[model samples]
Target: MKFGDIIVAMSIIAIVIIIIIPVPKSALDILLSFNISLALLILLISMYIEDSLQISIFPSLLLITTLFRLSLNISTTRYILSEADAGKVIEAFGEFVIRGNAVVGFIIFLIIVIIQFIVITKGAERVAEVAARFTLDAMPGKQMAIDADLNSGLISEEEARQRRKEIQREADFYGAMDGASKFVKGDAIASIVITIINIAAGFTIGIIINNMSFLEALNKYVLLTVGDGLVSQIPALLISTATGIVVTRAASDTNMGNDVLKQLFAYHRVMFIIGSVLLVLGLLTPLPNIPYIILSSSFFLIGYQIHSRLKISTEEEKEIAEEAEVEEVKSPENVMSLLKVEDIELEFGYGIIPLADANQGGDLLDRIVMIRRQIALELGIIVPMVRLRDNIQLNPNEYVVKIKGIEISKGEVLFDHYLAMNPGTAEGDIEGVETTEPAFGLPAKWITEEEREKAEVLGYTVVDPPSVISTHLTEIIKRHAHELLNRQDVKKLIDNVKEEHPALVDEVVPNVLSIGEIQKVLANLLKENISIRDMVTILETLADNAPITRDPDILTEHVRQSMSRYITKKYTQGNKINVITLDGELEQLIMESINQTETGTHLTLDPNTIQRILNSLSMNVEKFTSIGEQPIVLTAPIVRIYFKRITEHAIKDLIVLSYNELEPSVEIQSLGMVTLK
Candidate 1:
């Protein structure tokens, strides 16, 4: 064991022994002096700590100190009764306080005990109890705030963990202090009882055993008894005051002494007013003029000096700020900071501010939070924080959604109005301003509050202005989710999956394919609105086929085939799907035009043939839409990915599937076929 640890252990054992063993008067005096010194040190330490957690061990320390004081009282009582003296320290304390009068000295000792027990100890105990309760009550809120910051990327996982640990430590410290405060109270009561016993027993012993007269015994033992009480009570009072200071302390950047000096004298005007009041009282009232005049003059001098120093410092600060501003403009880091772009941003005009402001009863901010959570559940990728700010450059009712600093889509909403769109089944017409829905480009109208109910009754879908903007933003994010999936996001997904399937992640991540390759495959899936939440299957598929070809496109096709049941359930209704099929000639044509290179595969078909293929596919896709079914094209497994890529620009919402990427239980009905007609 370390030397300090050994000494602490030995000292505690010796303190317990001191209560039983007889000690020489000289050694008792030294031990008594040490007790007073230790109390003083504890008081100083309590005053300097910035936070209660800094002295988390104080509860245990308080118990030990109280025990030590009681032990000393026992030892002193033994000596005063048997030897007619406790030690020089106790004797000196008695002589200093008694001053030839025992009653007055004894009364002063009682006053100190009352103050320590009734005022300081009682107040500290109550504050500790309240503090402990408040700390425990606020723990849930503090933990939630940490989690919010972690999810929003404002703090790292390590930082969140540290904050949670500090919160727990604070709760533990206050709880222990609540119980430790009772020790101080108990020690005070014990001290009073012990002092009374010392006087009564010593008085009896002195007269009978030492052959002293009544008056002589009364004077001798009373003096020694009072001295012993003073010696013990003084240290007790100091420690009680320390206990109060510790429980009441709050977290701060500086120690208690500095905080007091700064906060108490924060306003120079208060000092000036005090000085004026004192000056008037000294001149007009019958109070002692000299003392008041001296104090008033000192206050006025200090206030004037403080005002002058503040003025000088303010000017110096302004000059330093100007210089720093110029230097900041010249710094490279400032320029670099300006280049940092958010992953997603929602900018709206002043009229739409209420939709994002919680104070205005707008739940757009809340809706955006739900949007992020929904995307995570559906796509299995964490969406970054969506920055919302008002833009003065746009119209009052206009809003724009941006991805990676570029505007992707913009929409307009009328405040205090609802947008109503017909779903091809509305039987009646509604009077409102005509508009096109930004999310789906369907014809809609801005209707008044009274017209909202009427429109809904006529089979029209109605939504509030905030919902209109929220839906538009949600669609824009979903469309561009592929662009947002980077290597870092892929790594986070891999780490999450690693918690469950460590060996699968280890085999597929860096060994079979790198993070960039995995990111590309996930992006491919997201581009088609496929959910990557089933990460284990995705990793397993990659582990099987990644060695054959490092192409992300090929790997993604393998993953899709493996997730046939999920895709079938997503698109099929009533165990049936209506889709367009590629003709045998068209499939063979695509297979022939496929060109391979070192980087990856590509289609080298001539422009004329591509346009003819697009025209034929467009005609076949229109047949499904005419029958109220979604446009799905069924092609061979080898040509499905290439066909989707070829028509992505011409047909944005096309769903091209392979025959193998379907459940056998579902029936596929081909409504038409794309042919080279």
Candidate 2:
């Protein structure tokens, strides 16, 4: 064991020993002096600490000190009752402090007991219990705040974890303190009982055993008993005061003395008013004038000094601020900061500021936090922090979403109106301002709150302004999510997988495929709107087939087949999938056109052939859209990748799935065929 650990163990052991074993007067005196010194040190430390956690060990310390004090009481009682002399410390207190009056000394000791037990210890105990209860109650809200910060990218995962740990520690500290305060209360009670017993028992023993008169017995024994009570209670009082200070201490950046002085004297006006009042009371009333006049002058002088100091300080601060502003403009770092590009930015106009400000009842930031979490669950990748900026350059209702400093999509919202779309089932049209739904480019109209219920009654889908913007932002992020996946993000994902499947990661990363290669595979999956949350299966598939082909495209295709169950469940409606299929000849022609090179595979189809294929695919896809079904293309495994490369730019929401990428149990109905004429 370390030296400190051994010392603490021995100290606790020695406290227990002191209760049983008799000691010399000199040794007892030293222990008494040490106890007093230790209590004073604890009190000073409590005053200096800015936070309760700074003295987290204090709860345990309180128990030990209480026990030590009780043990000393036992030793001193033995010396008083049997030998009639506890030590020089006890005797001196009896002789000098009591001044030969036992009754008065006992009364003073009773007052100290009442103050420590009823005032300080009782109040500290109540404060500790309430603190613990409040801390426990606020835990859920604090945890959610940390999660929101993590989701919004205001803090890193490590910072969130540290904050959560700190909150738990705080709760535990308060809970322990709640129990430890009882030790102080019990110590106070024990002191009174022990002092009474020492006096009564010592007086009887002196009269009967030593053959002394009643007055003589009372003089020696009662004096010693009162002295012992005073010595023990004095230290106990200090400890009890320290406990109150600790439980009541608020979070601060300075010690208690500084805080008290700064806050108490913060207002010079109050000081001056008090000084004037004291002057009037001294002059008009029959009160003594010298002390009152002297105090009044002191207060007035302090107020004047404080006012002058504040004025000078304010002027100096103004000058320093001016210098800092000039220095900031001259600094090269200022220019460099402007060059930094946000990965995802949502820049809106001033009219929409209320949507981002929480104080104004805006849930846009909260919605953004949910959007990030939604994206993570859907894509299995953490979306970068979305920076919300107010731009005066745009129109009051206009907002734009940017990816890597380039505008990807823009939308406009009516601050006080709702966008209502017909969904093809509405019975009639409503009179409103005509506008296009920004998310999907559908024709819609902006209506007021009065018209929202009427529009809904007419079978129209109505959405508020914030939802409109949030939906548009979500779509834009989903579309460009692949652009946000870099090697570093891929590494983070790989590390998370490694924690659970170390051998799988070790086999696949660098040994089978590089991080760049894995990033490409993940990006490809994200581009196709496939969820990579089943990372174990994806890695397992890669580990199986990576040796045969190092191409990310081919590896991605394998991972897709392995995730067939998920894809099947995601796209299937009523246990059936509606899809367009490629004609066998077209599939063959596309597969044959694929060119293999040192870099990777690519389709080398002539422009004419590519045009015919896209035209045929679009025509077949329209059939699914006519029935309000999502358009998906089913093709042979080899032709699926190359065919998607051809039609992705032409079809906005095209979903191409190979036969191998579907579950065997699901039924597929072919809506149309993409045959090149």
Candidate 3:
């Protein structure tokens, strides 16, 4: 048998084997689909370049395999490309055709093309979802700083900031997961429906044109039959059914239902009608000499004039613009605005405000306290104002006072997450994170020597800027430490755990554990050693490690700490739980829960703890079990955020603290802080 025929037979045998046992169905499906896709990819490339016959041989093999595998729809394939498409070349040359004739060939072509589109959409969504998860956490953290200002005292701005974070923490947690959901529902579905409509439409139009009485000569030129393909290639005929299923299923989703309407209303339907008219005109004319270029140019000129002279936008543009604005509004602006004051100027979160406006010359400690309180009340979170022993340079314009995150009030500080150093930096000073443009919010910050090593390990930009941050990490931790120490929930979780499981009081709730210890406790919790005692320990640790509100270096350290702590677990062992971890708050919650558990004692958190955490988490779907095919990056911030969310997970639609919260070094601390940041 010829190699092409042998390949065809082998392809058929593989499909049959897959159907018979079905042991690794998903893997098999992916492989089968992927192979067909690759084959079609080669064919399209060759045809696009007008490759020689030598190169065309590969397209045949690929086309044959795909046809035999039935991985593409035959008709949708007909519509996507022009006559130069590789499949058409096979017709021109008459080398081989398995399911001979225009109709069947096009149908198979549609299946392959549709399958390719589905794969592309699927891959794009998966990558985007992952990128979105990261961007969501980073962006909202910036917004939490800004959002604190917009709250009209409905809650204490600090409360607003915290609440906003709570909301974002949930959103980011879930957005990560939701992106994947949309891929299945949105992108994949659009492909399927688009394919089906195009195919049905193509056949209907094709038949009608063939039947028109004036088209007898044209009908002879156009091939249309379901059986007896060119060259009598037999192998493809046997397995067309399976290929049809794969291509159809892969491309199909309900999301494309709307697109069908769009096609009908706009380009496709018009094109079909135009083509039919021209075909009829061509057949009816006795002179039989209608130039295609004249027709095309005339149509083009008419379209351009209509489109240009009107200078009017239809509902579509309005809808698209509205959608774009919505997206922009939804994404958080990442720049921090620096406020200029008589005594000192500093970069704050979102908008800028002068320290002078807030009262510049005050007792040092009192000024720090005022800044802290104002930051919390205005931004719904605290900002630390640490007097760095060694002043971090402000360079007449740059520095970010990022205390875990910054919370600014409504004052007009205009530094944004995105900024540009207007005049390109002096050559010597090009060492920071440079901005492409500042008008839209991208800013130029110089990469610091320390941040370079850090950026390498965790994908963070290590650029420096010319502004001072109002709050330092130490002050933030100190302030939050106090609030968290005194938070009603923390108090409640502690007291409840102590009361319900007395032995844990000492093992879990004694004083506070350092950030390092909290890290350990979190790692252990993920290992499944969750208990009330462990949770208390984590809370105390988080409270301790939450950067001191007045220490700059401490604040920077906190972000690093948090990122390092995000929970990332791979599910190689039988679809185990994959944590699309939340930012820091959620992870803090998990650590808090586990840290509360005691060694050598019975442990249980009140149902309220579970419920509150669950409620806080439900706003975003990324908080719980991971159900996707994605590679996870388990960084500290991500872990510190999502680890705590494990407790709030719903089991079969009912919420319960996951039992895994109480097992071994359930406290899995992957790293030891060799040196404190």
What would the per-residue lDDT of candidate 3 be over residues 1-677, giving only the tens digit for each residue? 65897896786676555434432334533543454455456434433332122232332343445443332323213322212122342233222332345445545645544444455435444544554465466775556334433221224446666756555554453354334334233423443454455434434554474343324322222332211122112222222222222222222232233435434444433554565566556567654546753564455555565455335556668889999988876665522223422111234332222231225321223344455565444323223233222123333232333232343111112232322243422233334445442212335454545445544344333322212232332233333332222234344545665675566444444444333334343333322222223344445434555434413223323433332222212122332433233335534544454432223212244666656655544433342334333322233432332333343246222211222222222333211111111
Q: lDDT of candidate 3 vs native? A: 0.37
For residues 309-364, could you state the per-residue lDDT of candidate 2 as single tens digits? 88999999999999999999999999998999889999999999998876688888
Let me know the TM-score candidate 1 reaches against the reference structure.
Answer: 0.84
Candidate 3 residue 393 C-alpha distance from true site, Å: 19
Clashes of each: 0, 0, 146
| Ten-residue stretch with the least lDDT total in model 1 | 144-153
- Reference-based lDDT, each prediction: 0.89, 0.90, 0.37
Every candidate's CA RMSD: 4.2, 2.6, 24.5
Best by lDDT: 2
Clashing pairs in 2: none
Error (Å) of candidate 2 at residue 567 is 1.7
Model 1 Cα shift for residue 390 (angstroms): 1.8
lDDT of 1 at 616: 93
Which candidate would rank higher by TM-score, 2 or 3?
Answer: 2
